[model samples]
Target: MNFPLHRSSAPLAHLTPALWRRANRHLLAKAIAEFSHELLLAPQAVSRGEGWALYRLETPQSEYRFPARRLALDHWLIDAARIERRVGDAPAEPDALAFIVECRDLLGLSQDVLPVYLDEISSTLYGAAFKLQRERLPAPALALADYQALESGMTEGHPVFVANNGRIGFSDRDYAAWAPECGKATPIIWLAATKRLAEFSHVDGLDHARLMREELGEGTVARFEAVLAAQGLDPADYWFLPVHPWQWHHRLAMAFAADLAEARLVFLGQSEDLYAPQQSVRTLYNLSRPDRRYVKTALSILNMGFMRGLSPYYMSGTPAINQWLHALIHNDATLCACGFDILREEAAIGYRQPYYEAALAGNGPHKKQLAALWRESPASRLGPGERLMTMAALLHIDADGLALLPSLIYASGLSTEAWLRRYLEAYLRPLLHCFYQYDLVFMPHGENLILILDRHMPARVLMKDIAEEIGLVDRANAPPGAMERIYTHVPDELRTLWLLTDVFDCFFRFLAAILHEQGHFPETLFWAEVAGCVQRYQADTPHLADKFARYDLFAPTFTRSCLNRLQLANNRQMVNLADPSQGLQFHGTLENPIARFRPGAA
Candidate 1:
């Protein structure tokens, strides 16, 4: 009952200058490479005598150069070690924070947004320094580790986004307590929100009482009830909502003090379960009971451009969206054959401060602060000999330059190409089918997908973080009722982006590079295999031929939707959730890598 208000800070003594420099250098290399890819930097190629053309990005104060090889879609392959930063005739180390400040005008960073943006980059560097403190395991060793280990070990934030880990609201202490890389279990505080002010939704067959009994056990429930009764409150009149410990300490206790004092919002103390924060810091996995559902809470921290908060308005339709997706996936033979599964968000509960909601017109900062959702745990559905790991791990490379994909390939006892095929089969086919069959698309980034491994080979894909990120670009195909919220009338050109930008360009681009760099799969072959998978899927489904033609998966080129550009232009709320297409930053076009391999292509 007497947990301390503040936990110890994240260990920072390990952030030696050497580690800090390495972190900054890595961040700078990515910034230069991706910024150039987005045309924010015009890097001229310089002759390097050995037939290698190292490129240079020159600013007024400094010049930076690195060995890079251009790939499809202007993807930058920069050599970090070869990168050189200079300041007025003296060689200088690359500083991530300083680099941003130096290029503020170039990045089009506004006066108001620049400082807060810098804070995010600084926090990101701080996180990288802490990650460097841990023992660097080889790719083979890491591939053998369990799901959570692989998830936490991912060092690169987003391969393209420069300030990927900007958890601005987190104090150094908050970083240690809540950040995923800390690898520590955090206890969550439970709040009983009065029914009148809070909205709770769940699918059929699951209720609040059953969830409380399963999650807290009867003994803890009785204790919580006794506490409520002692405060002259009836437990039946309130719905239990999990509060992020950070929100409680930083925002809730003081901001909503009147509610707590009036006994409308009652603190039921810390739950018995120990949870590990996932890649998206706000969500936590039940380490105590792996089978229990994962809890997603709103921290309201500015991370990777948006306030990482669960919107209360968005919470209302989450369960309905998940149910729609689940039913569709189960009914489709193509998706079932591809072994695609979604971790359905079964229930969501949001607490609204009436005053805040009224004052801010429901878009207030605090409106999103106290909400939580229960998403079905992928672990609960794993069959025998199956293990789960975040899809991000496929791109993970250890300090020794060994990549996890090859190690997984080695462990699968299959040849490199065979392993690649298996992975694409498990992952890519379902995405294509979803687009062609249902006009449905998910935010299929690495962290959003969990790879179910059978003997170290990707067997199935478990999709998560539903309701919020999902979009239906084709409004005509929108199903009736609650599912209608996902509908958006995106232009026909942008519809293909669901696959072209998100899956092929965003995810597979890095994966293909890693596999090739590790000498396992060649870039051409990799894209060819992806092309083969698409063709095979098309052949199998003759009924969907017209749909396939409409949503062409093998177009010659697609819009180069720039991720960092969105952040560079507006670090706070980069993409408007209400209209994602309006927030898109398209920079010319990227030649589709698989264009030549398309069916009937010359």
Candidate 2:
């Protein structure tokens, strides 16, 4: 199957400023050309806007978007021209180009056609060689020679290329030019290959050709041969010219070649873009420092597994949070490495303490290590404020866990608000305020909470244990009374102060730590701004304190009222609360064993 491959001379735009600054002009031009070519053959039409060519494709099921760099090639070309003009030389545009091609939803099709398309286009558009005038072959190979002529003007050790035994070669001096940039010796080219020829060095001539043939395969060679045949050329007599080593590594050039190969054979199509995967959501959960560290470290071990992807499994009748958690863990190794250290410390502490006492008490060593770790290690050391804040965050989980824990506890089909209340009052509330005092805060989206659970409870501690510990569940599965009983027991003024100070303190502490680590002055200034906001809110709104007092007694109303007050105080920016709308779901399903409960059972 053949497809029309069109080349356009439209000026590129919207190159990411970051990339433009880092990439050279030749590289930028090549990247743009490749991107544009891919967009042209994309399943959906491409649109240029705000300095980017946004490729949009739609399958019968979903839409995909890809943004390719803009103005990159043009800028590079222009800069090169300017440099040439400054040196009183005429600008010469090379015929070589680069392109990028991407395929969408290849897995959804009965047969992927991307590889075939790529091969047809590449061999057609970029496979032909230029017929240089015989006299011009001695013109010192254009840019490389000119660049060499200006060697004295360049810094010492600058790269210089020379023709060696009819092949282009780089001197040690030339290799030096790239060393400072990449911190390594650059690979030097011994041959230069144009579209119609295969170049090789005398030192490794036959071996190199054999390797290339093996890599490209007879099928690819045939495709190249067919292209030349179409152009009425004899492949056997065609000379294999040497090309720059950098030319082969260029992303655009490689992409273009790959795309062509892909387009030529249905079996060689590109994979679907990961950035546009269907049924994907980034997951997060909160963690204590040590637990966070352990999770971060443990996550590195799962990178290969994550990249290969995992089948979705149900947890609580929803997709398992572990899948996304694993992905995050794999992505953030820095956080994980620290966690490993903390885990080792905890494990070492556990080895030295509590086992003898547990044995004397007739308890097995099953939990001896864990108990030791918890008791002796500073890694587990959490101040009152951190614990309280952590508890508060745990409450948010329990608020939802209640729906799942009863079924797990009793194996009953019945769902009961009674069981949920009993669990919340007896197990969850007592520890709610503890998190506040501990100055614990959830990560931005609360997705990091899973990491915390995975680290702490791991295997033995069930959700019920957590619920019971936090006072969400009563010992005998009895109701602890109304919401008032759960929250009203705490003094109104004290509750108000705790909530205000705890929330603000957690935010401030986290912001301060991150800012200080980043070494940013604005972060310090941000803390000052937060401090000023607190003072201004308190002083400007005399009713704020009274509102907090009222909300403490009317727990639900008070929580909302406090949130509203905080929002107003912060110029109407919404504050997060333990609310259902924050992607927190309470429904239980058949597959979730935790959601199955007996009637009248906790």
Candidate 3:
């Protein structure tokens, strides 16, 4: 009963016991630290004698004992070497999958989500092992590496999410070929959708024909048309789009049989250009031509708490949202002062399957099976002597345990304080101005923002994922249907959380930990520098004094939004994207680290 299973047999050769142990230890460290940050676990410090403190965390089914140091904002820094695992006090293998099962009750995971969640956890562990097996690149080498290399070489997934690397729908073969960490170049499958069923939109002056010509050269476009013409299909009636090769093989062929049978969706062969997957697995950069726009596709894989599907309905408004925000940024003096810009989503096309659109619910993932958007490349926007890297690279620690940020800091030749100050001005100041003056905010997470580097220090900030992530709190000031897709009624009190919880707590908390633990700077000095940035911005924008007081950036405490808690409650769809603030899972408050340095505070 032999079967053709060779493709799956050797893909995971790196998952040895030793590498598995290292990956397990790292995953456990993240789970313990992030779960504690979410307040799901209360670790008690116990003296192990000789002036060392070992912390004990207990759930209903298991106990974990480890030595850890506490940092600011209730962060737990677990020493991976000293971690111990047990079931009811008996020693056991350190299995992160088991840990999640043991704490399932405490984490509020439902019975239905437990098994699928475990599958995700195991895949994440495999990803960690694959990363650990790679050749160790020194911090300086990684800091100076080319942009795509650094993007694929990032070791840490999301800093806080335990199941951050879960690409649930990917098989072993798909993981090898498509996962960003695999560092493989994939040639995308091209498909033609009937114009009657698909909606295509682009920014003014950048129409569909021009984009096609620019992306697919005239020769390739003519060849594609010939392929369609041989099937008695007119290319003029069909719109061509790029599809993730995996999705085309695994989903569209099987699920949309009617469309194919009726010749509504015609197949075109692969494009000549190869694409390198970016940090966001769904977006790919054209490796063959660096100046070409990035292609972001609709993938049904579940990752980081939601099915990574681009909604067909939402796609209609994407170009409008990008254009509106682009114009707003160009007109605003405050945003320009910080050298902030966005990589605009210039063109988008979404295929609305008439069958699935009628059968599925409005929010179902099936309705978004085939779609792609073209985003302006940051590479095309680079100025002289400027290069780009995802801000997430700052937290990357090689397998040898050296941090990347210090190398970048040293290469800049600026004192640590001066470099951090410059970084904050580029990265954080625009966030402050957008929130206070315009009542607008971006999901300014590390992956969503690119750090434009000059001589190894951050010189400008380029925000991406624009159409989906930008939110406006003041709907009254918004023009009719400008950003209607993201416009929702967020309460006045919760408006600033787009900055505090998303920016300060989620992103900067780990960054501060990395810098302080690596001896680059003290945590105190880090927060004080942030305080100085806030104070200076407030002083310069005295006209917005009332708005500052209303939002109160210097407030002593802010809501501690629990990210893992939301995922635990419902891993499939943690929060409805339409109205995100309504689904927040709040667990008390975190005293703002910069609160003490507020004006007039001793």
User: TM-score, each model?
Assistant: 0.96, 0.17, 0.96
Ranking by lDDT: 3, 1, 2
lDDT of 2 by residue, 191-217 (tens): 112322112221112333453353234
Candidate 2, which segments miss by more than 4 Å at Cα?
1-293, 297-418, 425-427, 435-602
The model with the greater lDDT, 1 or 3, is 3
Clashing residue pair totals per candidate (backbone < 3 A): 0, 83, 0
User: What are the per-residue Cα lDDT tens digits for candidate 1 across 1-602?
Assistant: 22212233435765889989888887888888788888888989876545257788888678887888776666788887778999988999888788888898898888988988888788888888777776656788999998877767787767778888889888877887888877778689998999998889887788899988887889989989988899888889998889899989988999999999888899899988888898888889988888889999999788887888887777877888888889888998888888898999999988778788777763655688888899998887788999988988888877656788887888889987788788889998988888888778888998999999899888989999889988887788787877687887688878999898888888888888887777556788888889999999899999999888887878888888988888877888787787788878887888999889878867
What value does the lDDT take at residue 79 in candidate 1?
Answer: 81
The candidate, 2 or 3, that scores higher on TM-score is 3
lDDT of model 3 at position 258:
91
Quantify all predictions' global Cα lDDT against the true fold: 0.83, 0.23, 0.85
- Pitting candidate 2 against candidate 3, the one with the higher lDDT is 3
Which regions of candidate 3 are displaced past 4 Å? 1-9, 48-52, 88-90
